[model samples]
Target chain A: MTPFDFFILSGLLFAVGLFGVIVRRNVISLFFSLELLLNSANVLLVAFSRLHGNLFGEVFVFFVLAVAAAEAAVGLAIVVALYRYRKSVNTEDFSTLRW
Target chain B: MREVFFYLFAFLSVVFAVVSVTHRNVIKGGLSLLASFVALGAVYFTAGAEFIGIVQVIVYGGAIVVLYLFTLMTMDLKNFGKEPLRTISLAAGGAISLFLLFSILYAGYRFYGGSIPATVSGAKELALPLFYRFLLPFEVVSVLLLVATVGAVAVGRREE
Candidate 1:
């Protein structure tokens, strides 16, 4: 496959993830979108690494994976805490800090 | 052969990702996300990133999605309430993402003809650079993971 094919896949994934991030009100679904966004980046990174004939991009994917995991863990924790305080997962209800 | 599999998996991943994004039920959305991630891993495998592909499935499909599912169990889903479809945000999100998609395609257009070289990046092939050249960053990531774990526990813990 050509690099452009990978670009198409990555771009579509990013767009879909961005749509989800904007439209979805649920925090968990937001996280799902966030994961998609990260995955899209990973796809491009792997493709570029392959194109360059080096292992650096693949190695960097590991770091991205680790950061994604950490973000998921910490973000989920914050969501849970917010849910406990507010009794809702909908973003509109999270207006306590609103000016 | 590889190109066929790459296109197939790429199609599957994008389809599942769209489903994950649009589905109303959070649990179902997460499950579709899992499928999307696995399909993406297959795409990686087709691209010859075997180790990254396997790790993608194990980490994203197995760990992250499951963690989201568990967190869902803690919330009252019945009270999630009706999400009013505002025309403004829908238009905005659609417009922005469409623009971004086109921009990305345009950016990658110059790279159209090049094909990825034939090289299998399995764990063994990847370890040399990962362990030797990028060793410091690897250690930093480990530390970051540890700190994240502790922070998650601290934030999620119940009060005394």
Candidate 2:
């Protein structure tokens, strides 16, 4: 497959994630979409790393993975805490201070 | 053979990503997301990034998804009622995403840069620069993970 093919794959994934972020109401599903976005970026990064003949992009993916793990942990923690207070995971229920 | 597998796994990843995001059930979405991640890992493998692919499966497919599942288990899924789809928002999302997809593809098509060499980079090849040049970032990521762990525990802790 060509590097351009890789771009297509990554772009489509990013679009799907973007659509999900805009459309999904559940907090968990939104998180799922966010992961999709990150994964897509990883895909493109790996592809470019391949194109450039270096390991830098692969190494960057490692950092991205690290950040994703941390984000998931903290984000889920916040989700659980929010659930405790709101009893709902819907985005609409999250508007406590809308002016 | 490599190209075939790449296309296959890439197609699977994208399909499963769509399914995972658009599924009506959150659990199903999560499961599909796991599948999508695995497929993406296979894509990486096809590209000869063995270490990153393995790490993808281990960390993303294994650790992160499980963490999400457990966290989800703690919540009352029955309480997360369905949200009605807004036509206007759906249209907007579709339009915006189409614009992004088209622009990205156009840019990629226009790219005439250098192609990748045949050499596949493994963990060993990656370690040299990672330890020497990128050492600070490596150390900082560990610290970031540590801080995140503590923050999660603190934030998710039940009040007395």
Residue B36, candidate 1: C-alpha displacement in angstroms:
0.1
lDDT for each residue of candidate 2 in A35-84, tens digit (9 for 90 to 100): 99999899989988888777789889999999999999999999999999
Task: Name the best candidate (by lDDT).
Answer: 1
DockQ of each: 0.90, 0.77
lDDT of 1 by residue, A28-91 (tens): 8888999999989999999999999898999989999999999999999999888888888889
Q: Compose the digit string of candidate 2's lDDT tens values, residues B22-42.
A: 899888889999999999999
**Chain A TM-scores in order:** 0.97, 0.97
Clashing pairs in 2: none
* TM-score of chain B taken alone, every candidate: 0.98, 0.95
Q: What is candidate 1's CAPRI-style docking category based on DockQ? A: high
Please give the lDDT score at residue B122 for candidate 2. Answer: 81
